[model samples]
Structures are given as structure tokens and as C-alpha cells.
Target: MTPRLSNQMEKFYKFPDPPELAVQLRTYSVQRWPTMNHEWRKNKLASILRMKARRLASYWYAEESLSPRVDELEAILALLKLPEEVIERENLNELQALKERVARLEALLAQAGALDLGEQVDGGS
Candidate 1:
């Protein structure tokens, strides 16, 4: 019998994957690395994580106490909860502003394309 699996994944898997949504991020990662360097970067990150684990273990077992800055940051994170309504309101406001700016810029770009290139001004299309 042929085993069936989800088509969400390819027959041959790829590593160090960024989703299709991160279109520009994929390009930036490829540009940063040489050919086959993506695999190397993934391995390097794993090694660094292990090293950090060791450091954290050592720190935890040490007799030394927490630094004031670290303690303060922990407290701040714990205490920083916001109301859901406030967060939703803030997000909606930001999104509306972004949409407005995009609409205005798109309008200007369309106007500029309709005119001579050299005659376009910053404030007016």
C-alpha cells in the first residue's frame, strides 16, 4: 500500500525554512550566506544554543545572586499586562493610520505616472 501524507510538505524536505509569507526575508537570508551556507548557519545556531545552555546551567548553580537589572527586567515583564480592549484599540488605530498613508501614497504615485517625470513635486502629484 502507498502511504499518503499531507501535501503541505514536499516529498524531499528542505531545511532552515522561512515560510512563503516571508518573501523578502528569504531573499535577505540567501544574500547574507554563500552557497550551502544556510545549513552551516543552522548548525552554528544549534552550537551557540548549546553553549548558552551550559552558561545558563553554570549561572544557575553559582553562588552569585541575580543582578539588579535582570531582577528589575523580570519584575517589569511580570507586571506589564495590559487590558485587552486597550491593546485592540491601539492596534486598530495603528492599522487605520497605515492604511490611510498607503492610500495617499498610492494616489500620489498614480498621479506622478500620469505626468512628466521631472515635473512631479514631493507634496503634489
Candidate 2:
């Protein structure tokens, strides 16, 4: 067998095949599961959005500060069409606003569930 196929076979061999009835029962259970409630859905969506926004802001800041001067200048000139300092200030302000929005969402989520912001549902610290 080719190395790739051999590797895949090895991975597949790690788990025993389930009985057909077991598989059917698992599938049925999943299909019968109820949709999440509004508060749970909102909290999940807010968590995802906040994480994405923070990651994007971190990437933008890292690229702005860590790239070579020539590359940075070219990027600023080609993309921003404004002074670097102005762009940096604008980006910082936007990041700050995003953080504040996330904080507000967290507070709302906590209040909706009647849970403290620092508390976890599973009782983990």
C-alpha cells in the first residue's frame, strides 16, 4: 500500500467498528435532540464572534508592528492610502471598541442566565 493509504488504515484501525444497531441508535438520538434555547444560542454566538474579533485584531496589530519597515510602508501606501500613524490610531480605537462590545455581551449573557460573569456552568475555576 502507498504510505498515505497505510497511514489512513492505521488511523482507521484504532477504533473498533460499532454494531449496525448501535450506529442507528446514535444517529436517531442525534436527530431527535432539541434545538438550543435562545439564551444558549445567543451566548454561543457571542462567544464565537468575540473570539474571532479578538483574533483578527491581534493579527492586524502583529502585522502592523512586526513586519519590515519597507513592507509595512508599501502595505500602508497600497492599502490604507493614509498616514501610518492615523491608521494605527484608528485600528487601536476599533480594537478597543470591539473589546468593549465583547464585555457588554458577556455581561448580558451572564445576566440572561442569572450567572456571575466569572462563574462557569461546569463549576470550573
Candidate 3:
């Protein structure tokens, strides 16, 4: 059986490695070079983590510092809107009055139409 195995089959049976095993092996092997030592990689990771922590802390600080000011400005804006709210109420009242006037005019027109219809029926007779 060993004698019957081709070179490619022999290597496959000898190593029995997955396809991606070579890629992972080569990546780690390159990192083991003298210039890419373990301590440097550890420090680099530490610095990156520190920078991220500092950024998040600064964001939290800004939000906390500005929260009360934001609330104050919102309160001032509500105060500024008082006059507009009053104007809106007045406009709504005027619209209701116009609607009532239109209803009265429609009722009068309906009565006049009925009178004309009656007159026409009597005249035809």
C-alpha cells in the first residue's frame, strides 16, 4: 500500500493537514521573525486598548458636562414658543367661526331652493 502511494498522496497521508493549516502556519512563522518580537506586539495591543478607553471616557465626560445645558436650552425654546401657541389657538377659533357661518348660509340656500320648487309645481298645475 505504501509503495502504491504517489508523491502527492504520500504527503497528504503523512501530514493530514487541513487546507488552511498552511496559511495559519505561514502567518505565525512570519511573526516569529526577530523584528516582530513578542514584547512589541504586547505593547502595541496595550496602547491600542488604552487609546480606545481614553476616547470612550472623553465621550462620556462630554455628554455628562453638556446634559444640563441642553435641558436649559430646551426650556428656553419652550418659553419662546408661547406666543406661537397662542396664535395657533386664535386661528383655530376663527376657523370654527367660519365653518358655522358657512353652515347657516347653506341652510338658507336649501330653504330658497324648496320654495322655488313649490312655486314651479303650482305654476305647472
Who wins the TM-score comparison? 1
* TM-score result, candidate 2: 0.29
**What is the C-alpha lDDT profile of model 3 across 75-114, one tens digit per residue?**
3234323465574685578679989999998887688687
- Candidate 2: where is the Cα deviation over 4 Å? 1-80, 115-125
Q: What lDDT score goes with residue 70 in model 1?
A: 40
Per-residue error (Å), model 2, residue 58: 30
Per-residue error (Å), model 2, residue 83? 1.2
Per-residue accuracy of model 2 over 60-97 as CA lDDT, tens digit each:
33433432233323332243234557656865796799
TM-score of 1: 0.34
Please report the TM-score between candidate 3 and the true structure.
Answer: 0.28
Off by over 4 Å in 1: 1-66, 70-75, 118-125
Q: Mind giving the per-residue lDDT tens digits that candidate 1 earns over 1-125?
A: 33454443343243222233123223333443335465453343225334343333332233244222343223322322345566468657967998999999998778777885535465454
TM-score of each: 0.34, 0.29, 0.28
Clashing pairs in 3: none
